[model samples]
Target chain A: MSQAAAAPLPPSHREPRTERGRRTHRAILDAAAHEFGTRGYHDTGITHITARAGVALGSFYTWFESKEAVFRALVADLSAQVRDHVGPHVAAAPDGLAAEEAGLAHFLAFARQQKLIYRIIDEAEFVAPDAFRAHYETTAARILTRLQAAAAKGEIRADVSEAHAWAIMGMNVFLGLRYGIWDDSAATTAVAQTANSMLRDGLKP
Target chain B: MSQAAAAPLPPSHREPRTERGRRTHRAILDAAAHEFGTRGYHDTGITHITARAGVALGSFYTWFESKEAVFRALVADLSAQVRDHVGPHVAAAPDGLAAEEAGLAHFLAFARQQKLIYRIIDEAEFVAPDAFRAHYETTAARILTRLQAAAAKGEIRADVSEAHAWAIMGMNVFLGLRYGIWDDSAATTAVAQTANSMLRDGLKP
Candidate 1:
């Protein structure tokens, strides 16, 4: 997460208003996503975001304290969707692969809506690490908990230990990265389908 | 990779080099890994690095150029290990899981060695979009080639396609992130062993 929103440059100034303020805030965020998505977080600037958003420098501060703040918000929003998609379905899965696919669906949907945020969370390690690590640990724990619950209920396979559960969670995250977030090439659909199929069938003899 | 490393804030003054220069360079990079592993890329700075390295500001320039330069160098150095490991092995596998596991082992070793880089790569969607996409595409293509080669050899199952190979590759990358990079704590050796077993076996019924 960036403390500054736009890379190293000062975020542009903007006029304040309740409705317009919210609008400007959202625009700045969306622009930040675009910049982060296109130009990259490190390469992007606050000025770039405000310019894209058609806002003033002052307006950025009014909305987000820093790029990191906006980034956190971005991750929080996406995680919320992931949480929505994952929280229940994962708990309901009857097997390891089933659990994984349900969780993957959440991540895929999250990636579609919050590609920027997901990107940040995914890349939090490089740019804003503490925050990213925090998010990952939290998210991993949640998914693990759900898996544990399923295990308890005899829904998730009992043979899959808690630790292996995390690896399964890792698979879910990586699958989303391949299929949803980095699907820019449009050739990943088959990969997604087959991998998902493998997930359902169990990848062994 | 980052362009010429952003020159960090200049030292208050310049200093001459000695044998300590090599030692300090090593120290700086070691410190850099520690810093990057813990703090992330953006939050860390030359000042932080130098402080950790116990070298003066000017010394940073002697070894490398910018924080990003260090990062690139770090990632490059790490890639050497990754390349050495996975780069050569995927070519050797005679069958599906064998090919995947050969690649997976290399990825796991890389993650274990440079956990931060894998974390960053996984998160490239947000932190460094261009680089992440580049790596993703390049890696996918590389795996696709291997799959094609296997196809030529008649080693690949007729059921698996080029895209499925790429998704398998994606699964390997994700496995590294989920188990190796995301804090070795949450998961366990049993989980890894089991997952790796499945990774080699896959969910193919």
Candidate 2:
């Protein structure tokens, strides 16, 4: 526990101008993700993140005012990572259904490599409630937008709503947890294909 | 804050035989749920639980050896609570898809009352790793069994698999978090109904 944990962090951290400074910022955020993901938010400290990133204490303060600020940034960064990783696959799909399957497949693959995403995002519910809510809310909103677009394009059901978006998001998240984080014995594509079928035809006999 | 946080607890707690003992045990557990749910496992103390239950220190130790024991028990208890609450509704539904709808509706309703359930169960991942894994594994297993039975009965798609069960479970959970815990502006029936429509017929246009 550092003094940083006790104080309120600034709304945002300093934006690094130089390439070297940007790399240091990225390194700190990456290390914070691992530290917070593995040890949890409360148990992780500023010093630990600095040590993990191989950066000095003063350098940390230059980018992040406190542990909380870095954590907030990490949540945003991870959320972006999921989007950036899945977005291309989704964009390449020919239809809404294929887009969803591609999204799930890419997400599961991403989850396998970054198992800490679940932990850090979940812990944000306790440590950073706003960030936690924003992450899911933003994600759900994006799903809703896509579903509506697909509906307009006649690529999906006409009755797509926020509830449907939440449902699909939930399905993807839980599947990722079970297959992606808990165990990877099952093929990622197989799992995605199974869930995608349900998303396509549902459980109708 | 107590030594109990660091010390290893006995594997299991003593079972109460007498009626009075059972009553006391139940009270302690209820109090423990509130304390752990509100304050978190690491921050919560046995004294807080005892104080909340209005039971003496000795009474707390009578049924549970340490804070860890009670936390583990609470995890199991909450898991059972979800099952017990959702089971009757699921059983009463006329068909497999209807059963899932009923189950999700009931779960959302249950989550509204037991809002802290997500916090406590999720925190178990860090505080009690085995308990956390067991909670989800058991839930997913039960879901798979039901889905398989429905498939055999020709109620749902014949190709239903464990992946389908996990997907459905995930949908119910995220929907619960959003509609159940985050906000109650939307009707539970409406939320469940919308998601159920997707389960009955997916997003195909």
Candidate 3:
């Protein structure tokens, strides 16, 4: 467990770098994401990522200590990017459902862009576990806060909270799993429609 | 795929097996379940299962053709048990929200009793994927039909259709994933409440 904690960055002889060094670092991450997207986190090797990035093995060590570190950094970067992409959609919308619909559209588009996240969530069940929940909790928390704002506006259900946030987050994950893994083409539209319906109507049966 | 197409037994293996054979077979299944639950399907070995059961290797092979056969048997047995247990609760509930809530309770109880379903879902994500989708799709079909029934009864929004049905099913899956993998103590109640809220209220602002 301590090792798990140590993984985020841990201690490294790796020097923090300027733009050129950062360029090298970003290259490693981009290459790692591509490799992970294809081979999966568990099946992929550091050598594979380094080789694909066309960087020396020592360069990877300079950026990250373990494969887990590389993965964690990749995930962190992904979250930041997702949040950045989702932020405006949520902010620009006028109402709860509208905001949610817009936010979800952004998420789905982002999900399409980053097959890496899909791969991580998929294989996370086996390989780099806790990453799913860990990735999700942060995402869920932000979503809850956003929904809470709507509740304050008396637009959505005031009672909705973290639990609901997590549940819906799960919905997005499963949607991706179904469509991405199993190649559900039209099903993706069906999923989007469902999410839109829920965002608009809630489950008022 | 052929065996998948093979007509399923009529939800029973009660061909009046001899007591000794039945007992030994049960022991093997129990051991295999535990092995798969703990070590995962891909990671568990036939020897470990046999060792755990205190049965000879020859005996294990006698009862099952291979590890897949053992896993298939266990999954088939557990899937039937879950369907049987959930059948009444799902039937008793008359509306979408009620059905979803009853389902949450039944699903949690089913997972508690069969603890292995959790492992099976997790492991099957990689090892026995078709099995994962088969059970979930079957369960999803049941839920979809129930939701449709509720809609027919005017218990839910008429506009919601098979797509919403799939979302409900997707919601349950995330519930199981969270409860099983994250070790979150608040999960069962949280997801149940969330499901209830989502079904009854939607995320409308």
Predicted model with the maximum DockQ = 2
- Model 2 Cα lDDT, one tens digit per residue, A109-131: 99999999999998888888777
- Which candidate, 1 or 2, has the higher DockQ? 2
TM-score of each: 0.60, 0.93, 0.83
Q: Pick by lDDT: which candidate is best?
A: 2
lDDT of 1 by residue, B1-205 (tens): 1222212222332233677766876787778777876776767888888898888888788777677667655544444556667766766766755666666666666677775676444433344445445555555566666666665666543455544545555556556655566545433334345665655444333
Q: What is the lDDT of residue B74 in candidate 1?
A: 53
Locate the minimum summed-lDDT window of 10 residues in model 2 chain A.
A1-10
RMSD of 2: 5.7
Lowest summed lDDT window (length 10), candidate 2 chain B: B1-10
lDDT of every model, 2 decimals: 0.59, 0.88, 0.70
Of 1 and 2, which scores higher on TM-score? Answer: 2
Runs off by more than 4 Å, candidate 2: A1-10, B1-11
State the displacement of the C-alpha of residue A128, model 1, in Å, after optimal TM-score superposition.
2.9
* lDDT of residue B78 for candidate 3: 75
Tens digits of per-residue lDDT for model 1, A163-197 = 44445555556566656665544433344456656
Tell me how each candidate scores on DockQ against the true complex.
0.21, 0.56, 0.49
Tens-place lDDT digits, model 2, residues B42-70: 89999999999999999988889899999
